[model samples]
Target: MQKFQELSQTELESLYHDLLGKYKNFQEKKLKLDMSRGKPAADQFEISMGILDEVNSKSSCLASDGMDCRNYGDFDGIPECKAIFCDMLEVDPEEIFIFGNSSLSIMYDAIGKMMLHGVRPGAKPWSRCEKRKFLCPVPGYDRHFSITECFGFEMIPIEMTPDGPDMDTVERLVASDPDIKGIWCVPKYSNPQGITYSDETVRRFAQMKTAADDFIIMWDNAYAIHDLYPDQKVPLLNILEECKKAGDPTRVMIFASTSKISFAGAGIGVFACAEEMMARMKKLLAFQTIGFDKLNMLRHARFFKNYEGLLKHMEKHAELLRPKFKTVLDAFHSQLDGKGIADWIEPLGGYFISLNVMDQCAKRVVQLCKEAGVILTAAGASFPLGKDPRDRNIRIAPTYPTIEELQQAVSLLCIVIQLAAAEKLLQISPEK
Candidate 1:
């Protein structure tokens, strides 16, 4: 196939008409497919069904430290449960706080707490600050941006390279601006793009100078152990330890969860920071609730047992996920490769494949896909304010749909991409 850019006007029109015919045929099928979010498929959930049976009405419901799992104490989390997260996050038990289900909720509360009460006792509340800002890496997670946006912080876009966010810009901005309170980081297997932060990026983050005494790095390790290739797993430096080593024990707040590993709505969430910081957050958390679901935590502890158990379970997830991702990538290679219309990353782990279609065409490609009965994440959802400056990047989530569904959806996606690219080169309206 000729590259869309090199094709003559007549050739481009002919190609566009052929793609349009295929697109109309798809529209006739009345498909109800969705690829909007990184949700675990039904089959992936089946592998973790044993967790429900791990704790039952007949179970003792007692934690390892003799605390009743049915009771309200242990706001930080039960001992055995904390031990599992400690191993997973490479932090001490005292440095971790376990919450229910969503790490996103824990993150929201962390920000809200700072806004209402301030970062520490003597510190002024963030709401009172003349200016509040957060650093957001481009083509990043939407929810992360939403959290800071909800708190009324002005979000600054940071360029993301394969290694990670542009640290030169991150260091320079945070150093000069006392208003830049925090930066959102998906350090390992980051959302959408799946680019892990290099060791130097992590080191710089830990050792960088910040003008704000209460500055923070929101290190969200949502895909810490979500490896598609077991033998070739990617390594991430532990930022919490690095911060402590830098004599800035309070500079980082790390979060992780088993939402994907087990039941998405019923799994455990954890927060890790300095022991003193943990103590301070606990005081604020006490007003939120008596405790999170301890019974659920106990069930997870007994089911996974340790970090190795979690890894083994993720291997099963990879078994189910690897093929779905392949279906998308394979379709892209066969149909879209060398077409000069699109580009994509082959992620080793994480839930999304980032596809960059021709500039000024992603929104049209997505609209065409939706018109053909396939749904996708909004074109600019990966960026802050849901606006992609180039209007080219689209996050493809292949995890929720079945392999058969993915095969159809990706094929349609490629076709729409080609049609959109051809339309752009020919300067024709989509209706034409």
Candidate 2:
């Protein structure tokens, strides 16, 4: 349990030799494991197989309001699906708009809309602006950064505190600039770190002022109902309500999907915002398609009769995912705890464990793991523009692998961490 820095040169050198030997043993095993993405395991999917049976040829593909789902019409969303989201997202049904299977796709379209048209009616389109920028919290989702990057928006990396993004800086930056148009947020069970925004943070987000009238908060609440521990669920204050109370109702746009709950590609994605924004969103979306897959939406609504049913279904998912998370965390404690080489957050509900290795060691550790047959999310992937300024954070995804497989991967991962740390230490030590 001693910190690596506390060891003497002689002890460090000996430890380095031991770690090198462990690394070689891993090399000999030639294991091929991938811990790159936070994908649900096969066992998790098995419990939700009944969803596919929701709409069969014998079943009536009709919405509760008697709109036939097999045909077209519900462009915004069927009332049934929106009502489900209203309960899940803690917003009114009128505030929600359902989209295709991927929330990421909806996000992309939203950004595209902002670039092509303004955020809302009568505002200037971002394309006409001389400069455009987006705030991206560090160790954040790469896909969110990618959407901004693709549109050539200047991405300003914001430091993430345990509570949330550094709001003092966010407030200052937004107050001073009209060019800073938006911020990408994953409020509950955030992508890589799994830190939910504190209530104060959400309130500040709602009340923060910007020079630009069109300033928006892209709230991707992907894990709103994804509780690993069903009994001790964390509650998130609805940002839409906060914004409305703050008299900035048009400031936040919420996104969510059931990709992890049921099926990845076949799930329903929903978009929620103020009434003004939703109206603009609907008008823009009408130009793109006649309507989304209402049958899929009906299937989801039927499978999970109410919000309670969705939560109950997620319990089965938790049964499969909990062990995998524990296996990795237990391995970290057993093998790397108090070593001074790495640190990580124990997430409550999200799919990843954010591990921070010594500066300059993450890339080396990832390379060493890959060479030893374990694939990991690339170093610096959690940051904007694929660059982690410190090059220290690594996202650990445990849900996709079985417990045994996860144990093996974590075992090798620990070895690589030690090997990389020792190598870096030895290079700097005067005794070398």
Candidate 3:
């Protein structure tokens, strides 16, 4: 196929005319859809209908450990639940600590606690210090950015390559800058882009020597089990294990949850870290609450016997999610396959399709879709402080929509792309 740059003016004009005619036909369809957030569909949640049976009116409120789940007492969460999440997160049961319903809240608390009363891990509290910066990778989770944004930390946005974040830049920014307190990472099936960190990237992360002892790697493995392709899900190098191999187990804070596995707003969150880190984390947790919901923890523990059981259940999840992913993927390639106006990656697994339009056209593309009644993730959501440097990347979530809805929605999305790209290209053409 000829490259867009090599195309003659006549060829370009002809191509534009064809796409414009296609876009006009799309306007007649007048589809209404949303590809905004990575939410599980109602059918997916049916798998957890058994949760109602995990505990019942006839069931005992007593936990396996002897703690009454009815009342608060387990300051660190029920041990059984920690064991279950330990398997879910692929860490030692002893290394895992179950938290509240939402991991995002716990993440905020961790940073907030440090702000108010320095990191009690024998480091300077952030309140008294002036230099506190965070490393943020572009095309990342927006909510993750929101968490860092709240603290007023200087966010350094790193460009995300196919393999992962630019590690050379990461090494320099992390090692040389003492002010670089932390870096947010979603290594496995990363948000938006759905690109997993390679083993080499993990090795680089493990070998990183931060200037600050308290420097943390907030690893939010949110979509670890939401693999759309069960067989092809790229397993992470286990940051905790890798850290130990590098003699830095305390550096990475591993966060995972059943948010997508079970229910979105009601699932449990876990934080797996080295013992030393946990001690500091618990020190901060002491002021928050005496304990989290142990009953919910017990329910999850009994529902998933161990790691194998959890993996088996995730397979069922993939069955429901596969069609949704294929619907959008097929539509994108079908309509935009040879178009030089845009490009995207075919992710092996995960809940999103990251589409990149021609330079500086993300906002226009999204607006075009919205006008046709399909909402998308915000235009610049994939960058630090919500500003994509290229202004072209867009994240498409296919999980919540049904297969039919996804097909129609993706079709409309193709219209948005074609219209936006044509207008932008025409502006640069000599014919304009």
Candidate 4:
């Protein structure tokens, strides 16, 4: 259990050879295991199956406001659905807008709208500008970066602290640069790292003055109700409310979804902003579709009657996910603990576990894992532009695989880490 760096050159060489031999053995076995994306396992998806029958032939198709669920034209969202999300997101019903299945789709549309027409109601559209930039919190979500990149915005990487993004840097950057149009935030149970923003961080974000009149804070609270421990849930300050209190009502856009709660692709997505901002987005959204899937919204409203029902459903998810997270963490502790080869965060509730390998060795470790029959989220995937500056972070998604498969995958991954680290040391050691 000694730290690898503390060992002698001879000891390091022997340990490296041992790990290499184990890697070869695993490769020979031809194991086909994947830990790539944070997808719900089959059993986790099954618990929400009852919602499938919630709006069947015997059910009422009318929304609370008497709009027929089977019909069109409730573009904002059915009242019942908005009511549910309002309670969950802690926003007014007028401020929330419902979209079809994916929140990512909503985000894409929001960025596109900004590109074409401006983020704020009357500001110049981003497309008309010569330069545009987005502040990306590092060790952050890949898809968020991809979205900004697609729009040709320069992604400025901001370092993430345990509390949140380095706010001092963010404040300075936004204050000095008018072209820095927005920032992507997972605020609660953030992707990869699961670190929630501190209340002070939230307040700073709410009160900070940006150079750009149209600057936006994209708050994607995907795991708002996704707590692994029901009794130990972390609460986030309602950013919209905070912004309103700070007199910057339109500064933040909030999003959430039931994708993890009910079904992956079949669930509903929610978008909430200040009333004026929501009005602007709705005008843009009207061009896209006459209406979203209201029937699906109705189905959700009936299935989960209120926030309490949503919480109860998530508890079921936690029951399934907690074990998988524990298994991964336990394996990491057993094989890599005290070795000084890597570091990681133990998330209370989130889809991924962020593992930090030695600088310059993450790619090698992932490649080694693949060669040994395990798949991982690509090395450096947690940062802007898919480049981890230190070449370290590796995102671990344990929810998709069973405990037994995870056991094999995690075991091999640890050996691969040691091997990669050992090789890295050899390259630098004077003894060589």
User: Model 1 residue 375 lDDT?
Assistant: 97
Worst 10 residues of 4 by lDDT: 423-432
User: What C-alpha lDDT, on a 0 to 100 scale, does residue 270 get in candidate 4?
Assistant: 93
TM-score of each: 0.98, 0.98, 0.94, 0.98
Which structure is stronger by lDDT: 1 or 3?
Answer: 1
lDDT tens digits, residue span 1-432, model 2: 899888888999899889878888988988889999989888888888888999999999989989999898988889888888899998887789999999999999999899899998888999999999999998899999999999999999998888889999999999999999999999888888888999999999999989889998999999988888988788888898899999999999899999998899889999999888888888898899999999999988998998889989989888888888899999999999989999998888989999999998899889889988999999999998889878899999998987888988999999888878887877854123
lDDT of 4 by residue, 60-119 (tens): 899989999899878889998899899999999889999999999999999989889888
Better of 1 and 3 by TM-score: 1
**Compared to the true structure, candidate 4 yields what TM-score?**
0.98
Clashing pairs in 4: none
Tell me how candidate 1 scores on lDDT.
Answer: 0.92
Evaluated at residue 282, the lDDT of candidate 3 is: 81
The window of 10 residues in a row where model 1 has the poorest summed lDDT is: 1-10
Q: What's the true lDDT of residue 220 in model 4?
A: 97
| lDDT (tens digit, per residue) of candidate 1 on 223-290 | 99998899889999999888988999899999999998998877999999998898899988888899
Sorted on lDDT, highest at the top, how do the candidates line up?
1, 4, 2, 3
Report how far residue 400 has shifted in candidate 2, in Å: 0.6
